[model samples]
Target: MTLLYIHIPFCDSKCHYCSFNSYVDKFELKSAYMEALKLQLQADLGRFEIGPGDILSVFIGGGTPSTIDPALYEPIFKELWPYLQKGAEITTEANPNSATSSWLCGMKALGVNRISFGVQSFFDDKLKLLGRAHRAKDAIDAVENAKNAGFERISVDLIYATSLDTPKRVEAEIAMAHKLPITHLSAYELIIEEGTPFEKSPNVKKESIEQSRRVIQSAKDAGLEQYEISNFGDPCRHNVGYWEYRPYLGIGSGAVGRIEKERHYPHGILEEYIENPHFKKIETLTDEEILEEKIFLGLRSDVGVDEKILPAQMLQRAYLLAKEGKLRTREGGFYNPDYLLSDEIALFMLG
Candidate 1:
């Protein structure tokens, strides 16, 4: 089966810790950028036409997709809605600051069924530290508005590792996330990317994985099952495609397609993506690589994997980790119960 992704590259303000293919040109460039995207999509349609066995999952990801002028949406939706599969999963990535009830209503009217809100933190001070534009109140209010606008499936995002982000604080965020109406939560640790402004700053990478583990466990304690290293949900669909090694097509700037993907990189995903939209350096994986990825991704999830598919070496290590309660295996393969500890375990195993 095949899936689709559409990247949206606009944010109300640049976060101090972001290094994606986004610009601060919010005024003059917004309209023109949308036009450019339309041109690109028009030029790309022939090569990516729909076929049988396709599962359409259009994700409007971003610098911040919700910040875009809603005016740009209708024309594109009109042009492309004809080809969508009957039970398609159409989602949009939105920042809390831009997710107003009217905006969500318009999106629902235009066929968006899923909404993923970028709510880095529910504490005002932590929000400021992450350079987020919205207050915690805005996030709570946005989710409420999204529900009122008829969104049946909603996802929320949280950043785990940050200064002042104690295990207790992370646990508190988990408690808050559980109480909210969102069905999915992508709770990720803050990693400082090279060349991002925060990378040069001293405190951006201050939190440890050991401390973060407590917070992730706190989420599990709150009923949000860890489905992947950074994602959690019930009946997760979008991310499962990635972990389970399903085919997908990604469009727009900085997005990567895995319909046919190579494990090795071209050093810079953004540079190559802008220069060549063929998912430059893309390769259809060999069976071996696909199997390796399946074990790797499954081990990171609470769902675990099938025993026969796991490599012998990975199985041995999984047993050792399981004895320590760091990982567990059932009739299925293995899973990192405290997935927040996964990074350190991977590093140690690799070393």
Candidate 2:
């Protein structure tokens, strides 16, 4: 079963740490972008040979999907309905400030069953530091409103380990998040991506392992299981599709798609994509590259790589690593306990 990811590249405001291909001044391009995106999706559906009952999940992520008018999503959903499975988990990432009750209800009516809020923190000061458009109360209201609007599966994102963040702060955030009707939580450590505002900001600090562990323990205490390094709870199926190396389609500017061993990337610039929906760059991955990805991606989540896929020598190394307590074996595959060392373990086993 294949997965679909649609990227919305519009945002009301750009966050300090975000380097995503999103724009705050491009509000005028929204309608044109949506039309172009739908066209691309329609063309891709035919090109990929996607038919009725072939898709397992759909994720609409963005610069801030909530900022867009939900009515514009109808056409795309109508086109996708025939291909979606009976109980496909369709999700949309929304911002607290813009994910109004109306937007929530509209998306739900359009087949979106899950809503992931970009609630980086439940503190006004932290929100300000992160350049978030929403306040602490806005996040609470958004979740409550989403629940009231009949959303069952809900997720919230948390950013920890910023200079303004502390162990107490993370614990408090987890406590508050647990109190919400959220089923999943993606607690991430703040990373300063180069070329972003945070990269040159002295306020951004390096995250410590101990700080992360404390935050993780708090999430676990709040009933969210650490299924992946940064993700917790039952896990997002669409994201899991990526971790398991399943072929998926990506639509919109700067989006990447992978079908079998072939990968496709539409133009990174929004204007270029709008001019020609087929302005895509494609690459076929080598077997070695695919294998390395399998190991790397598999180790980062609940689904570990099958031992059968490894060479005999690599399998022996995996066993040795398991013995040393770096990795754990279960269900006929090796799993890493400390996801931070996943790269090191994968490389060591590869050697």
Candidate 3:
């Protein structure tokens, strides 16, 4: 089964800490971009030899999926309908400000069963600090709107470890999320990425290991189990497919896909992509590189590294870590109990 990811590169505004390939002034190109996406999707579907009922999941990610009209998405859904497996998880990411009731209901009509809202925080001040366009109440209403629109699997994204973040603030944020009709919550730590506004003001991000721990504990207390370091509650099948290294078709500008050992990157520039949606720059991955990714991704999430994939020395190191209780061995794989130490553990195993 193959996973499919569609990228929408238009946003109402760029966040302070976002370095994603998204454009705020590209609203004029929305129609053209959607057409380009279809072009690429058609070519890729044929090239990848994806047959009916072969698609495991579909994730429409973006600058803000709700920015586009659901009418525009109808064609894409029609194209995918025959190929989607029964009960396939179809998700779309939306901003609270743009995810209106009409928008939510429209997307649900197109078979998007899941909606992941970008609700970084519950505090209006924190939202402004993060350059979010929505108010605290907007997020709450958006989730309610999604529920009213017949969405059963709803997710919210929260950002912590910012300068204004405290243990109490983080707890309050989780408390607000718990009150929502959401089945999943993804609490991510603030990473001031290069080329973003936050890069110039590095002080905005106050990295605190304790703060992260607090966020995790709060989510757990709210009944959202931590399946990955930054994720909680029910696992996203599309993301798990990625961690498991399943083949996927990345359709759109700035999107990426991996088929076997080759990674395919569509053009990053919107104009360039619209001109030639079929074009792709491919990178071949070596055996060692793939294994390293598996180890890193596996350790970072509940998806443990399979013992069969590890080399003799690496397997021995995993055994040692398991002995020390840093890792747990189960079902021919080694799992990391503490996801916060995943990077360090991955490095030690690599060494």
Please give, for residues 207-295, the per-residue lDDT of candidate 1 as tens digits: 77576667657767877766677777774566676666666666666566665544322213333344444434556688767765665
Q: Residue 174 of candidate 1: its Cα lDDT?
A: 81
* lDDT against true structure, model 3: 0.94
RMSD of 3: 0.7
Across residues 1-351, which tens digit of lDDT does each residue of candidate 2 receive? Answer: 899999999889989988888988878888888888889999999999998999999999988899889889988888899999899999999999999999999999998999999999999998998999889999999999999999999999999888877788889999999999999999998888889888788467658989888987998998898988899886899999899898899999968899988999998888888888876799999988998899999898878989989988989999999999999999899898988778888899899
**lDDT of prediction 2:** 0.90
How far off is residue 163 in model 1, in Å? Answer: 1.5
lDDT of 3 by residue, 1-351 (tens): 999999999999989999888999968999999988988988999998999999999999987899999999988888899999999999999999999999999999999999999999999999999999999999999999999999999999999989899878899999999999999999999988989899899999887888889998999999999999999998999999999989999999978999999999999999999999999999999999999999999999999999999999999999999999999999999999999999999999998
Question: Candidate 2, after superposition: displacement of residue 29 in Å?
Answer: 1.6
TM-score for candidate 3, residues paired by index: 0.99
lDDT of each: 0.72, 0.90, 0.94
Q: Give me the runs in candidate 2 sitting further than 4 Å from their true place.
A: none
| 94 Cα displacement, candidate 1 (Å) | 0.9
Question: Could you say which candidate leads in lDDT?
Answer: 3
Instruction: Output the lDDT of residue 202, model 3.
Output: 94
Best by TM-score: 3
The all-Cα superposition gives candidate 2 an RMSD in Å to the true structure of 1.1
* Candidate 2 accuracy as TM-score: 0.97
